[model samples]
Target: MSGHRAYTPSLRDRLTKAVMTAAGYLPGPLLRPVAGAPRRVDGQVLDPHFQAGLRVISLMSEGEYQDLTLERARSVVERSAYTVSGRKIDLAVVTDIVLPLGGADPDRADLPARLYSPVDGDEALPVLVYFHGGGWVLGSIDSHDATCRYIADTGRLKVISVDYRMAPEFLFPTAAEDALAAFRYVRDHAAELGVDPQRIAVGGDSAGGNLAAVVCQQTRDAGEKTPDFQLLFVPATNMSARTRSYELFGDGYFLTRGNMDWYERTYIRSDDDRLDPRASPLLATDFSGLPPAHVATGGFDPLRDEGEAYARRMADAGVKVSLRRHPTLVHPFVNAVGATPLAKAALSEAVGAMRMALAY
Candidate 1:
């Protein structure tokens, strides 16, 4: 028997890619009317709205963003985000700011961050320190703008989206380092941000979710005030993609194992980096005394098992854990909230948990 190889698209896959590519050159008016229907990939039935979004994505490119240079991939993601996520909003008093990178680097400048507050509130609000996910390689505050807005509006809490430094520019520990620095910055400056320092929570989807989990563990270890709660949406909890979910759902879904491998390889400086507890929170020895956690996973996501596994570990280690697995959905469903009822409902459920946990 042979070991697994990178996925090779079938003839149909090739044709689909070609057709979608051709459609991309059509005028905006011609393309605007197209819609995608619910279709099964392998055995899983993708959500109709999510399927429609995938059509839009298909028109943009073939294969994974992993194949492109960091710059080109980022441009594609940005354009797709704007097309799928709609325009950035002025609601919630959104502002851009710089947060110090902390930790004894005289030359290290502050990180870029964005703050989103609910419209017109006199009292201090609970805040969710958010990180955008792109395998720790491709996302930014702008890429995840719409999702942040949805979270802020639905959860009725302030949201601070952090633009942590990424890989091929800055690797593993840098992103994690920036996350901790941003968390500390917000906690220390809560008064100025009009947020209740004590009520500030941390959350993110996919790669960002991994950072959130790591930030929680780092806080616990440092004897610092822990986040009020954690909102993880399809977080990649472990760098080692050996889990069964990865094997079962790695190829056909939106997130492929090959792309995942590309992400891990790009973000990690050395093979040993995979075992670092900060990079892979599931490898952490202790989970006790961490804040309450709500972990959401997609049944068809390559990263699903690790997220659920981490939740199980948290539960066993006496931490409060809430795990929601959307059996029919794929990764990145949270971003589909604007188009899919299922995605919106799932996000709403997670945010409601945050609201209850934070008591705001």
Candidate 2:
């Protein structure tokens, strides 16, 4: 601890602090060297810097306290060889197709969506509206395309990944409503999109995953049969620091306590809204009658405990549930299918859960 690097928040941290102070109330890995590059699947060489970044994180976070920020979040991973190394990660990951939203509304939430469909489907098929994760700040349809494409091609389910309004600009329920609109639209044109009204689902990762959960609650409160299942990938369920997860694994993993503190402060503008169930599902009184759920968590992620607890809570309430944990992976590894070896296996398990829920 004596040789520890002095504590300093990253760029994302400074930005978060600036925003919070403006409001006046104040808020807020391992592996050994294996020579040139570790041999991995597909004959791809492991990025040495990634391992280096992990070392840096461990050196700094061993027993220290620091402000979390998206910048620091990126620094730990980006500093790795993945982004800094000379080699380009130009793998054609996946293809995206843009779809036009018909109607002369003149302001039809202009956007481009890449559709992924099941293997066989003649009539209406089950559709799953999705939102990508970036703490309600980062991430786009592009970042999550790989997972969507896999669902479309393998599960045979029509996966509609939505690009919603993010924060510091359009926080809180903005993304939630956009997700609901996409689902309602998908339901409205079930026949055209080849989607079955009764079989639609909603899901996403991290922040996106949180949105998916909110969408489910929104649909149900509106007196509608919610998505057949809610697939939350390492979702940030609670905004406040009341949960045991927040207290237990606050730091040390990829998703540090700092990263979360910064994210919640950024996403929630009105302090009153932080307690809203839509904003933080953990505060919701009722978990009954919600749709079935399949939640995945990375063992090393700070948010891991809450996700697993939510799954258990749903099961206790009689809602069907399955929670899977990837002990060796980080928060964003699920979609790094080609970049990380654990991705394929973990995603496959998730896809299986989806297929079972959709029963297609």
Candidate 3:
């Protein structure tokens, strides 16, 4: 738990990284004519680097998630995580552990988790209980290892990345219930984990973000202690309906409309389940007492409109919320922190907000 090591990339991974890094440096003028004039939708032009990257991805991709079998889709995500997550950050402590699910179900399997702590920090630090994205049907602690390491090292805080149960196997409410359980366990055991119970934060991207928002609402409605802050990146706030962003950017973006439909079908029981507040936090009755939040959205992402709408809803309900729209980015920017400087900077900004919010 008190050492650091670098992740050795495979030959294919290294080659892929090299190609992407090179593409990032290409002049915009050279890329524009080929990738099509800088796409301007919703008043935001797509980042030239990302446009080039997307072109590369499209050329290299085997198939979209909607077209791949579930197992193949999951494998593709795992490989992509390693390829684009960059090198792992060095931290003072990194350890794998199991979280006991001790709530209503005593017989449930313990969740796999990883804890990351920076070298420079006090004995007790603010902690972010993070969840990985993949429409709740993919991703794992391994997939988000670099992300947690980056947050822990750069933010000078502790991070516990939860490996929640996924879908097509563990249906609706399972992931949501597990997320709540993980947060509760961390809060209740903060002392043992050497984290500040008073400053615990909940965060995640995509489906994971949905869980974080739901956790806040669930705690509020149940009259329990809530997270000190919430960080949501490209969150699917409302799953019941598609928004204008979906209509605009859903086709060519990394997260396509068909992919989202597949995820929903794999994760939920029926159309009615999509309307449940647990599945769609925006449909919740109240957002007034939820913790302060930073909702970051990519202008080109299908989830952009809903994410912004969620932030607005929270603010209107009297919750303090910060909505950051990265005009030139896409859905997976958070995962690409190591692959590109811009993505790294974007994550740094969000982590900076988390640090400031928990500084007290």
Top candidate (lDDT): 3
- CA shift at 353, candidate 3, in angstroms? 1.3
Superposition TM-score, candidate 2 onto the true structure? 0.72
TM-scores of the candidates are 0.86, 0.72, 0.93
Give Cα distance to truth, residue 102, candidate 3, Å.
5.3
Instruction: Estimate every model's Cα lDDT from 0 to 1.
Output: 0.78, 0.63, 0.85
> Which parts of model 2 have CA positions greater than 4 angstroms off?
1-31, 34-111, 118-123, 242-249
Please give the lDDT score for candidate 1.
0.78
Residue-wise C-alpha lDDT for candidate 2, range 1-360, written one tens digit per residue? 000112334675444334322322211112334112342422233233223334443644423223445444334332221221221222222235444443576334544555666444465767778888777765566556656766665565678887776665666776666677676777777788767888888889988888888888788778976788888899888776555545555553456677666667777878887888878887777788889999998755678777887788778889988888776566665555543435556777887898888787
Tens-place lDDT digits, model 3, residues 1-360: 111123445788679877665655566666776477778887888887778777867877989987888777777777677767766578898998888774466435578889999854458988999988999887777778878888888888899998888888788888998899899999999998899989999999999999999999999999999999999989988878899989999899889999899899989998999999999999988789999999999989999989999999999999988889998899968888655667878889999998888874
Worst 10 residues of 2 by lDDT: 20-29
As for lDDT, the candidate ahead, 1 or 3, is 3
Q: Which candidate wins on TM-score?
A: 3
> Residue 78 lDDT in model 3?
72
